[model samples]
Target chain A: MPIEDKQKPQRNDRVTIRTVATHAGVSVAAVSKVMRNAYGVSDALRAKVTDAIEALAYRPSRAARGLRGRSFTIGVLLIDIRNPFLPEVIAGVNEVLGPSHYQAMIGVSDARVQLETSLIESMIDYKMDGLILVAPRLPSEILAKFAVQIPIVAVGYHDASATAFDTVNADDQRGAEIAVEALLACGYRDIEMLSLGERQGHAVSVVRQREIGFRRAMQRGGLGSSPAIGKIPIASPKREEAMRKFLSRKDRPRAVFCWSDLDAITLLSLAMEMGVRVPEDLAVIGYDNSPTAALGLVNLASIDQSGRELGQVATRALISRIEGRTASEHIFQIPSLVSRNSLTRSGSGTDMKQG
Target chain B: MPIEDKQKPQRNDRVTIRTVATHAGVSVAAVSKVMRNAYGVSDALRAKVTDAIEALAYRPSRAARGLRGRSFTIGVLLIDIRNPFLPEVIAGVNEVLGPSHYQAMIGVSDARVQLETSLIESMIDYKMDGLILVAPRLPSEILAKFAVQIPIVAVGYHDASATAFDTVNADDQRGAEIAVEALLACGYRDIEMLSLGERQGHAVSVVRQREIGFRRAMQRGGLGSSPAIGKIPIASPKREEAMRKFLSRKDRPRAVFCWSDLDAITLLSLAMEMGVRVPEDLAVIGYDNSPTAALGLVNLASIDQSGRELGQVATRALISRIEGRTASEHIFQIPSLVSRNSLTRSGSGTDMKQG
Candidate 1:
């Protein structure tokens, strides 16, 4: 490498709009509009400015913008910020946002429609450029209507209603089947499941698809009678109480697959309280592979959908939408089952049980 | 309870920006500028506009402003999204942000300096109003310069200087002493410590204080004759290979305290690989009480600085700074130990001599 070739480029310390305009052969006002993604730019001019920006590896100075349009904030409204699964998804969102000059601000809606409504209102009030909703329980009408105004991505909702915002979700049915298959492979026959109930009776709802898949997998395995399902209201931590009735039954399930690791953890704690030995009298598997599930006492067997991957996809969807793409529908991400110590014995008397 | 009251609220929703502008006797542009937090607004006019905004409950639609100044996004950057300790800090942050009408967008920087720098830069470029950096590893000079331009809260860094940016970190020296004392109380005379090296000599870094605390505790206990500290670079897994040399030694300590639960986990995993029984052969203690430390197989006894509480404190500090609190200095958070299964059965029988 010659010294002349490697010489420092001209001082573009704060790459000025003038430099870009000069390079692209356009007015500074035109360049400014392009930077703001404003209207009235010819497609050819936009392309020329963009190409110049890339070629120069230009990074616009946010300080000079004076808290104006270039602060690169991406708003993330989590249904529940404490929910273990959302962390991974946010991580994935960060992966996409990292390169695109965006940072995410997260809000915990606590799965309340009203709180979420206020939170989104606040995000909009604050002027976030983009928003992501994780497994929101809100009506699709609100989401669809909102999409017309701001770039939005909904994660964990599989069905793509044209009106609802762009979506990134797992094949809940396939994930459910995989959960059932894991139990069957471990020699389970009487495997039950626990899940959340659908709010608006949509096929795209994760809870509904997972429940259906569980039923289908059981039926296909020659079990005419479907396994029992417990659909309880979320945030009602009476899991120990609710699970007691199921555990006290005569024909109990050898294993129970839960929709979330939190429930399974509660169940395990409850079972221990009830003196039910794990992987002996009963076995438990859960979803989300939550960080809490990996805790020593919980050690839940879970399905790994990689919420981060979902977040990454959803972010990409929103970026695509932000970039003026006209077409976006349902995006079904795949989920994998992580075989931890939580799920081992199945259908009773299986020696593959972990130490 | 009557529908009449609801009807009145619906009437309130009818209050538009134009209505506020007309009421405040200002041009719509002036109101818009106040709403956008743009410069050049006189305090008197700003107060007048703000009063009108509050009275009318005039919310600027996120849709219309989607292309304008306020993206309404707040960014949270963390070293790793998966750290079990962070949720609590985030929980606190949400508590503060939720009511103040700010939404948080989180990015996982994977504890990398370059990644964190880029994430911060990108967030700034996108128009984020403020940022919270959790356990960041960037240089102070870079951070100081960045803080001069943007509102930043640096959590988990204990800087002695009045500080260029707001910071919150635990008293690691005291925290380390508590761990040592707990182990000493358990009668572990020959105790060892597992820690990371003093990398890059960052004054505000955590490990250095922890080591000082450990050494001081040993000296206080009259065990400073041979301070057995095992250094490991957890930044890379290859360095984990050092655990055996310390574990298999003839003069091995009966109880070992670690810097973090991750270190404890790696030690335990290596112990299992080396066929060394836990608690029975050696007692281990760790810090952070990370979810992984509490797993079924690795019930590590550790300190809980409460990442959640730290996050809450840091958020409050940042908010104070944003609200113009010029007198505040760096905050040193206190920590408490959470003893679990790892720090058991030390100084009994011939544990140390036998090893």
Candidate 2:
């Protein structure tokens, strides 16, 4: 009949999981286990506990909740923002995570092993839940071994064995085969392919793979009668000069295939400066469907692998691993095709053929 | 003696700044103040503290080290990853911060206010030292007021106030003038321009300024008899339809000036679908030296703004402000010009005389 006195003071503003558990008539561990949605809880109990949580309007501190893992943040290691391929990959990763509560924080390593290592250490120091490394320069074995101890995924990498990491690629072998086949279809024999480096690494540089595929396709077609293979040193200004040597030879190949859009661009610039016409003086094909390839100045024929798809698949793999799904290593590949243009022949010189 | 004592037991494991401060007969604040190189510490005292710190090999904890407020991480909010301008800007930012121990983390808001707000909040949650917002859609009042509370630098923004933020922007007015004048030089009187929606409340959007400059330049060139303007509805798939309708008019313009490279792309697509040859039926020009504009399929003649320079300028301003420089609201009015392309002149019947 008598209402209790109403001047009850609040103890603390913070709402802990323990309080929610007590209010829900359950153990604190049960509340936390429910909060994390950890295994071994009945659906009925989880529903009851979550309802109570909603009623209390409980907001857990990220710091306290993050101690056992799951910072809800994904660290992205991008070596070069200027790579042009990265933006698509990043977009794919964002597409994968945007709807979820996870956030991405990107750090640029600029291709320096020391800087990449430092960036990784800093991300680890900050306790990011997972990481996505795009085109890292570190030794694959070292990276793979390090990845086992940490939740990580690799994107756009072709060489690393997947023992210690999850990876998503564009099927470099297939992509190269497609590019080379397109060039072969154009009836161009005696092709010269410009690689990032002959010694850049293994046959997986995507660059290296494309070159091997070209060579194999040429061999299959018996088009390598003259065999005029050349390589561009990585990050070298001599790339253009070396390209010039390939272009000016008295018996130059009738076709040129480049492993990168950047290489294709250099070839185009050289062609223009030397007064050589695209698809006429030489037919050129490039990889990476990079935005540069679409430019009117170059109009290079290139392989169109989806960098964004690669990023999305890698991110999904990392998140799945973080979610305690099947661990170990996983690889996902996306298909790509050839984009016809000024540098791609259509039987007639200087024409974009369409059926 | 020291070797024997060290072998027995080393007292150096816990040589934190706190211990060093006590040993140097100084307050913890004094040690921290010296570490930050802040004012109010005497030379002799700093020397004494430095000697003691070296002697103890004291390492300051990152959490406790920045009581005066510094996280050494810069948060950058970009418009969209699809836009090539941003990655170029980030490259410049990295150039400045690479050797300075400052790291940049990017979040793409994609020109959305709510998303931008969420991104800023996420950066804050991560304890970022400062922030850089590139072409945000939020009002200047909200951004300016918020900037005072936090160290924020605006890029590609033209707000003329120092209340809450410093601004870095290209000379868009000059850029528009160049775009129009180039068309005039190519013998075109009826030059139509496309623009994004010019929002009210703040003269922050460079699109608004560019539009104004385009109008003024057309007027100055005596093309006032029949001025042309087109606005593309955002999130609309019918952008080409709008451009096609404009192009198909009996009194169609001889030249089309695109506000951005993306708009130009839509116009080019529409032209192709409509069977209107570029530079023949209509001359096309775009702004922003986007890689898409350079593609052979889309060799759009357009204005070039140094995204790399804008990034460099913004980073320099932020670093200077962090170092206690009094300068604020620094304006960057970089030059703008058009790149010559296959689309500079109208081809046949649609070609108009330069009035």
Candidate 3:
């Protein structure tokens, strides 16, 4: 195909290095050397290869570049694709990478440890420049091991002491404390927490961090040192059944703090179905302040962690690491409360106090 | 690293092909040839390479395989990630790929034509085996040109006349007809549609197909050939403002059908804020029966297109094409209506009639 054919709408044939070499009347190895800017190529050979490449519109394959050097692609591994929070993080990563030469390719692990490990290995095998793992299911030690092979920045993972990789997170402890404080401010004395019933409670996991924060905040408020924390199953049917049982319990608390808006929104829906009024029958506050929580029908008060900011910070950290930074960095941003109808009848604006 | 070192939790050194060659007392080219199973490699050479590979735990890079042959990875391009419906499609794709050796890598185009083109080209340059594009923004001619380079299966695009690629849809026109019929059955004569204000009115888009169905169904019911179809802007602030304007219109129809659950759910929220009672003051129907529609608080009646099943069918079609079936296939699934509070006061079950 000639250069003019490149502009045709029906053109589909890819111009490879072989086509460039044939056009330049040179061996394939000579063309590869010139393309790579190898030391031994003469000016005349370079000009011939360059002219042929321009004329043929021969773009080098990213796979070939991956084998030799940088492919200019960043790999992102998400533990779950369904979480509304994860998409916000992706939007942030894309915003920072939009103008640059680098592009992002994402892999979903479905929150399985084995799948997460394989996806990480595959990204490494593809020779991606760096990785951004969002709420990975892998343990800290395993993540550290992967970090040595490639640049890594973890979002929503709470391993601040690790020296192998970087970590970016919203202060989960503070977020939970704010949730509890907001409920207390509204004169709720009897309060409880609804948390995820995770299979593995990795201390570095955000759920565990929130639990610790919940306990400490309850204790500081002169409530029982071991305040009630109810476990909610992650999957459905059983998830809804458990919530229904809680709603029907005779000793149910007057107020509740949920670990996530994912569950909090569901609880509100079930409350409406069961004839329980929010903030009237059961005051509730949740975390992650997802878009759904702000709906006029839902209006659940929540802690705003800002997943987008976490993503932006993680991407910048990964780029700095790829650019030759040696020391590992740990970053945190403070989370605030978004008071709404679920917290109090009058709750409707931002509450910025650290509490 | 030796094979024994692979068991260590902290060992991170990667085993390269050079280590395998050194262990086998052979040249790197000999190992590469044996790995590729080239015709010239004798049994003895293959045995030596195999033994050394086992002892050193050397895994060939996927990038290297991509340059020569299959990398066993499928690329999925999503136009927008924020839409909750897209995740169901991804879930379906993952379910089919879970038992197979093939894996999926996703790229989000965020509805930008330039980014969509670049991502598709990048996927081809990466030497991925095939592609599945969900609601892509590219033109038919451009997609056809790309289809010649690699096997492609498009979901939610309605170009049945194209021979270059396969398509899987949910019979969007039929879905719209069902919506209109259901509304008419419930005694709603004043009906309208709220569609996206897209920059390009591609005939292949589902929105346009739905418009065709809506007009036909109305004319068939003795209404005018052209009915009121409100244009809703896609971005926020503007998106919300447009919906609010439509809700406040003095001539607002008694019933409305939205192109997607995304907008319909938002409209429901605005109606609640503006003191409009669902089904009493306004009846609404949405497409893509997303999870949010099922929430007890939302209870939005919508067309159930089954995005997950669409994803599964598209994956199967792409794989068949990748295995060398040249004839293009355009597959479609019938959509149904899920009745809820938004449709009418008594709407609470599945309406299976395909009007």
Give Cα-based local distance difference scores for all models: 0.72, 0.71, 0.89
Name the regions of candidate 2 deviating beyond 4 angstroms. A1-69, A198-204, A222-228, A233-238, A265-275, A291-300, A342-355, B1-69, B185-187, B197-203, B233-237, B265-281, B291-300, B323-330, B342-355
lDDT of 3 by residue, A175-254 (tens): 99998889888999899999999987778888888999999999999999899999999988899999999999999999
Of the candidates numbered 1 and 2, which has the greater TM-score value?
2
Each candidate's DockQ score against the native complex? 0.21, 0.19, 0.40
lDDT of 2 by residue, A151-187 (tens): 8887767754566777677777677667667777777
- Would you give me the overall lDDT of model 3? 0.89
Error of 2 at A235 (Å): 4.7
In model 1, what lDDT does residue B188 have? 84
Counted clashes in each candidate structure: 29, 9, 0
lDDT of 1: 0.72
Can you rank all candidates by TM-score, best first?
3, 2, 1
What are the per-residue Cα lDDT tens digits for candidate 1 across A214-290?
99988888777666787755645464456777777778788899987867777775565456777777878888887
Error of 3 at A199 (Å): 0.9
**Residue pairs in steric clash, candidate 2?**
A294-B295, A294-B296, A295-B294, A295-B295, A295-B296, A296-B294, A296-B295, A296-B296, B280-B347
Overlapping backbone residue pairs in candidate 2 total 9
